[model samples]
Target: MSLLDRFEQAFMPNYGVPPVALARGEGTRVWDVDGKEYLDFIAGIAVSSLGHAHPALVEAVSRQVATLAHTSNLFVHEPEVLLAEKLLGLLGAPARVFLANSGTEANEAAYKLALTYGRREGRSYFVAAENGFHGRTIGALSLTGKKSIRDQFGPFPVDVRFVPYGDAEALRRAVTGDCIAVFLEPTQGEAGVVPPPEGYLRAAREICDATGALLVADEIQSAIGRTGHWFAHQADGFVPDLLTLAKGLGGGLPIGACVGFGAAGTLFGKGDHGSTFGGNPVSCAAALAVLDNLDLDHVNAVAPRLRSGLESAAHPLLKGVRGRGLWLAAVLTEPRAAEVQRAAAGAGFLVNAVQPDAVRIAPPLVVTADEIDALVTAFPKILEEAAQ
Candidate 1:
């Protein structure tokens, strides 16, 4: 039997089957089991910021696993403390950290932080951006504003108010004293790399402060140099009381973190929140390696180059390109974003259909100018064929 056939009978059909079975990867490229090479622009849904098999990440994980892999939460590991210090330094905030295993777990950590923050006074409500994607878990899903995903999930945990994204006024009014916090993505990745208007974040910060609500920035897709910023909330100078991170933090391995600043940092006392596998030495080591390689100067320098390459495009299929740094979207004229993604793959590129009419690009910061040129060169033809 074929590998796919054998797998179907053996494993649960959770993710069904991936279209391609990857055997190996290096830098910005991956090869399927059949040995067909493809430029990996998806970056594992924005998870592989440094690309597959980056030396730093591999070495870090290997070293940690070889030395001390799993130590229970009962013992404090040096890697965890070091990672916390690194993250706090990066954010330039006095904060406390809770490590987790995925984006959902990171948001779950944030949820607990919100609950703790809300327990004070009388606030127990949460406000989320409409069409937002938080996580699949119950608590995070409760705050996720996507109706299609939530409707099937049934009545969510508690009070969740969904408001139009990017509308500061709408968000301001929605988050009152009864609200614990507002969850927002700097650039809505799944919703198509949509960046809020300038001053919007600052305005939201003001409202949250006035109402005694915490501002939570979900940087799962936008952080870790994807947008040439350490944290997306820093773009507008908004220091969120709570911050959630995952995706690129581990370079490729799974890792997540919920960061609480100032008073929010002390919201949860001992025994309030805990995770068994979070802050595992291996994951922390991998994340530290990612940080070591992804220095601010280097990642920041790549942003303008990526923006310039996409912004100059004048094609029939493309409306415009939007986003920051290496994270961007090629807004399409048609809702056939999936077709364009497939065609790009056939043309030796790998992009994503983030929305029906937007193709998102969250390639590794290490992507070369010539590779981008290759993308730009093939882009017009890729769209033309997709048009067929």
Candidate 2:
């Protein structure tokens, strides 16, 4: 049977059975089962930081899996310890790390940490932005701003208040004394790579301070060198009390982390929480290689070229481009992003129509100038075809 055929029979229908079945990948490219190659702009939705089949990641994961694959939370392991230390070093902050298996799990742990911190102080309300996408778990979903996804899963256990993203006044009004924490994304990713106004995070910090609420920054899609910084919040020169991370941290392996700073670091008690396969040693090894190969200098150097190339394409269908570093969105003049995506795929490139009018481009950090130029060259034609 064909791969998609097997997938439909075995797996849940949540993903709707994509058309192509990828057989192999190398660098910033992939080939479907029939051996048609395409440039990968989605990069596993920003999870493949070092690209597919990276030697470093392969070797590290191989060596670690041969040595030690997993040790539950009941025991300690070096890869986990080393990875935790490495993450803290990258953050350049004194914090404690809790490992999980994916972005949702990371946000779930962070939510619990916030709840634990809040319950101690008798605060019960949680605040988040209107368009922010956190995760799929119930509590995290409650904090998520999109009504279409969240409203269906009614009667979430927490009292969550929603405010307009990038509006400091709206956030300030919502974070009253009853509020426990304010969950936010430094840049809203799934909402078509939307970045807030300058100094917005600093404003959040100030507001959190005034209300004695924790500032929890969801860095799941923007951190780990995706945005020319180890963490996106670092570039803005302020620190969130709690940070949730996943995607790209483990290269392609599944891993996540909930990092807590200052008093928040010690908020979880003995019986507070735990994960069974959260700190799998193989995943940590993969993360180490990913971190080593990231090379911020190269990313910073290449990013502007990519951005300017897309902006200078000068197609009538192009509205504009926005985002920081390698994470970018090409805004279309019309609401035909899905058509543009299909056109790009037909032309041997892959991109994401994250919204009706936005195509999100996030290739691996190892993506070269030539690969970006290929996308830029093909994009105008792709847009033209989509317009038809």
Best by lDDT: 2
lDDT (Cα) of model 2? 0.93
* lDDT tens digits by residue: candidate 1, 1-61: 7777777898998779656677899999998778889888788888887888988888889
Q: Go through the candidates in order and give each one's C-alpha lDDT.
A: 0.86, 0.93
Q: Give the per-residue lDDT of model 2 (tens digit) for 280-358.
A: 9999999999988889998998899889999987788899999999999999899999998999999999899999999
lDDT of model number 1:
0.86
After TM-score superposition, what is the CA distance of residue 144 in candidate 1 from its true location, in Å?
0.9
Candidate 1: give the clashing pairs.
Answer: none
Quote the lDDT for 296 in model 1: 64
Off by over 4 Å in 2: none
Displacement of the residue 9 alpha carbon in candidate 2, Å? 2.4
